[model samples]
Target: MAQSIYLGLMSGTSFDGVDGVAVQFVPGQPLQVLAASARSFEPALREALFALQTPGHNEIEREAQIANQLAHDYALTTNELLQQAALKPSQVQALGVHGQTIRHQPTLGYTRQINNPARLAELTSIDVVADFRSRDIAAGGQGAPLVCAFHAVQFGAPDETRVICNIGGISNITILAAEETTGGFDCGPGNALLDYWANLHLGTPYDTNGCFALSGKVNENLLHTLLAGHYFALPPPKSTGRELFNSAWLNIRLEKFDTLPPQDVQATLTALTAHSIARAIAQFASRCQAIYVCGGGARNPALMQMLGAALSTAGLAHATLSTTDTLGVPAQQVEACAFAWLAMRCVTRAPGNLPSVTGAAGPRVLGALYPR
Candidate 1:
């Protein structure tokens, strides 16, 4: 196969910002990241997005406006990526953009990502690939953890089992077993709840290096309450988003601990993420030798420390944990690159979803193309 350049744009469930990358993929060689750029969502836009996570009045109009706004943000970031890479729109093959997902409910046979791909294409003057999840949902799959297929290509080991744990707003693990097919699913809440609490108590977008969490101790009672959620115990081929683990959900669970110290709550939330992820690894990828983490959660030292302890408790004491930066990809950029890889597959007419990972009826090409 010949080499081609594709740009990828992503705004994860964290609703924090847009991350864009210009990447070149060549046959038999590791993919090269030409350029990367990130732009945070303005406070107003971020609030609007968080509000839309739940049902609200005038949602159709609100969501449409937000989609338009998101396309503009995506285009701006894409332009920055292109400029940084010293490439023009005409030189790029296409853009793979994963829009802001407002609701991910594959069980209900629908998933919604707010995006205006045509507008993005018009703004950027390049072919655009968007709406990557619905097709998998149509095929009876979770329509998520889509990054696992990309993980298998970029991080898989032939002689040893590896786990790629991506902790975005929601945490998910991709199991790349040396002797078995790849598997993954949403493990549980990631930075979403932690960030929410941080924003609420500290007036910051996220806890810097988990300092708020490190200042307190994990309350086992609250931790037990969190672990008892039905989602954590569900088998694989399942996924979740803010739809289930949002502020409202956390508030309800916090009613019993109203007098609990805010810092303790933060700490428990961090532990919740660590324990849930550790449980998933133990249950599905018990034999995994090393776990390479990606996404925003990798930056949190407290969370990482908690994860290490949680792993020891889960009987995965021998498993080592580290960030994907050691694997030639920055934690924040893996998902963006994954979508770029996915877009390449779509452009080549190859299947993108792995039936084993997503429980899709079969592999399916996963994106909608909008030509410039």
Candidate 2:
């Protein structure tokens, strides 16, 4: 039998960069991470892509052009990673490309992510699995938190309950029970508000280790007001993005805090991220034995400290992917690797969508395949 390897490419909600991970899978064996690489998006491309997230008046033709450009950029990213891994296109089974997410209003039964797989496949000369969300949406699912399946495979334990929390632009937690039942839902905003405030006040992409936030003090009044949002009060089996918690949304919350300092606001926003995530875990996953943190937010020391404090207060244990003793292909590479695993599942006609996580009607196969 031949070895099966798949490349997973992902551009997360952070709009920061593209990440690709190559993995090899053998029958009845654990998947092995072969190679991984991440490339930051160029300023121009990033700006164009970010602008599309807003409710702007843009032409359909322009959107189409941007989609093609994104696909090209994704192909370039894939080619670079493949070269760095020293693997030929033929050595890989297929490419799982999660195109940039511009809009993900699954409630309306449609989600738009740029990057045409056919164009990408033609450009990269590899079979492509793209559009991983639509099928789940079609099946009355939110088409999100798809990582739960991958988390179930990698982090699930036979005798213990575990939760994997991914803090990207938004935060989502996957709960794996001792009985092997899995559940997940969007907790709330992760770094999106913090980054927005930092860019506006500090002129930086993010708060390094929550340093800027640490310089100030959290505003309890403001934090309370921010937490009052309806999304935070909602139950599980839900997902969210910049659509509900972006600059505009933040500005609305800021309207009430006329006396708060900008730096203090940054501090409060960071607190909000940590508090909201921790609150969700406490409320929904208190019984879980451990929580493994991932994504860019995991790198922030201040946030980590806050998480630890919050978890301790809740009488829950604080943990991270790092505590597992291996980089395991790095925090940044986990989601990209997930898409690769999803693509592999798609090729095999295996069910990739988790019904309990996404509130989908039931388990379903994920992704649309585009041939080279």
Candidate 3:
């Protein structure tokens, strides 16, 4: 039997960069991470992609250009990882590229992740698995937070309940409790609001260690207001993005506190992220015994502190808080490896979406394959 190796690529909600991972998964065996790389989009392109996430005029042409550039950039990173791994295109099974999610409206029955799979396949000379969300959406699923299945597979504990959290531009969690069906959903904003607020004031992309936010105190009123978002109130099997929580949304809420210090507002946003996730965990997975965080937010210490504080106050003070790295997978590589796992599943004709997690009609083999 040949080794089953798949390359996974992910450009998360933050649009900060694409994380490419190459892994080999032999059936019934632990997957091995072979190589990984991170490639960032140029600032101008990043802004354009961010703009397209929301409504605006003259978007069609701009979006097309952006998609092409994204594919080109994805190929660049994929090629680099392949070279570093010293593997030929033929040796790898396929590439799973989660294109930039410009819009995800599963309720209305459509989700858009803009990536030219055909072009990517042509450039990489490898089979491509893309559009991993639409099929699940068609089956009445939220079609977001698609990585929970991967989390359940990689991090599920036999004795203790484990919560796997990926905090990108948006935040989400996977609850893997022993003997209980694994489940997860988008908790809320992860770094989106904080980054927006920081750029608007500190002129940086994200809060390093949540320093700006640490400098200010959380405004109880603003925290309360931000928590009132309708999406947060939705039941499980739900997902969200910049569509509901972005700079514009933040700006609208900020108008009332025009005189508030920028750092205070940033602090409030960070708290909103922490409070929302902690609240979700408490409400959905009260039995959670440990939390393993991943993605960009794991690097933010102040935010982690707030999460710990919130969780401790909720009477779960003994639950351990840490990143996925403690479990062998690096924080940033988990999502990328997830896409790789999804690609391998698709190639093997295995189901990807967990009906219980996404509220889909049934389990389905997610992602459309574009052959090279």
Candidate 4:
């Protein structure tokens, strides 16, 4: 039997690194994750990318250089995947590379993922699929939480309603109900603010195991203020990123409570993620019997514990809380695997965005290809 192989690369809102997976998709069969690899961005490149997240002088040239750097890093990870899988580039159908997102404003009718796909193709000698969001935005959709479609196919169960919560820099959810339409939307800030506070105070890229959060008490007033943001009240078919939840946004809010301990703020931010997600599920997916978490936040025991408590407080105590590993996909790899599945759909000229989740005008074939 022939193998339908594709590679997916993702550098999500966390700006931590690139995660790549080489997967085989057999129709009516479980996906075979042949190999997985991740590479942290060089400190300089990571800082440059983070700086690009906001407006700056001489932005155009800076962005170009960073994009090229990202492509080189992506190629390095691609090489690692090929080595691990022992498969030539020609054997893979395409590379679904979600370039780092510097801006995602679906309301503005444009979203930018900085990447030089042509360079990636040149370096790897493989067909590359990039820009998977703009088409949906053109169709009047959120152009995000695109993983919901993949989640449905990869994790849905016939006997139960399941919710897949991906907690990257921004948290999002996908609802899979038996015989019901799959739906999802971004809940709110995930690890973005948590990581920012950790880096700012603890001198770490992230709060390992959420020990910092667990060490402090959540400031209820701070949590209340964080939840009062307009984004949380807005209905679904929506998405957000650093654009609305960056350091400036947090610092401004923090101005009101300088006396609060940094660890306390971190604890509140963690709760903010949990409570907002719980609210989304309670209001939108209250019927979901299982909540499977994936992404960096899943590894945070403190955040996980808070999420479970929040759900219970939201009247979903019966719902189970666990990571996607129970479903055979590691928590951190779900988004990367999703892009791989999307690349397969793109190469086959099939629709990849779900109108139910992204609220597109209709199904659209996502991604632009740069053929090797």
TM-scores vs. true structure, each candidate: 0.99, 0.95, 0.98, 0.98
Any idea what lDDT model 4 has?
Answer: 0.94
Clashing pairs in 2: none
Who is ahead in lDDT, 3 or 4?
4
Per-residue lDDT tens digits for candidate 1, residues 34-84, read 999989999999999998988999999999999999999999999899899
lDDT of each: 0.94, 0.83, 0.91, 0.94
TM-score of 2: 0.95
Q: Specify the poorest-scoring 10-residue window by lDDT in model 4.
A: 1-10
Cα error, candidate 2, residue 97 (Å): 0.9
Q: What range of 10 consecutive residues in model 3 has the weakest lDDT sum?
A: 310-319
In angstroms, the error of model 2 at 136 is 0.7
Q: Mark the regions of model 4 whose C-alpha exceeds 4 Å error after superposition.
A: none
* Ranked candidates (TM-score, high to low): 1, 4, 3, 2
Clashing pairs in 3: none
lDDT of 2 by residue, 127-237 (tens): 999989988989998899899999888777787677788889998888988775688888889998888888888887888778898888989898899989999988877
Give the RMSD in angstroms, all C-alphas superposed, for model 1. 0.8
Q: How close is candidate 3 to the true structure, as a TM-score?
A: 0.98
- Tens-place lDDT per residue, model 4, 1-372, is 346999999999999999999999998987879999989988898899888888899999999999999999999999999999999998999999999999998998999999999999999999999999999999999999899999999999999999999999999999999999999999999999999999999999999999999999999998898999999999988999999998988898889999998899989999999999999999999888999999999999999999999999999999999999999999978999999999999999899999999999999999999999
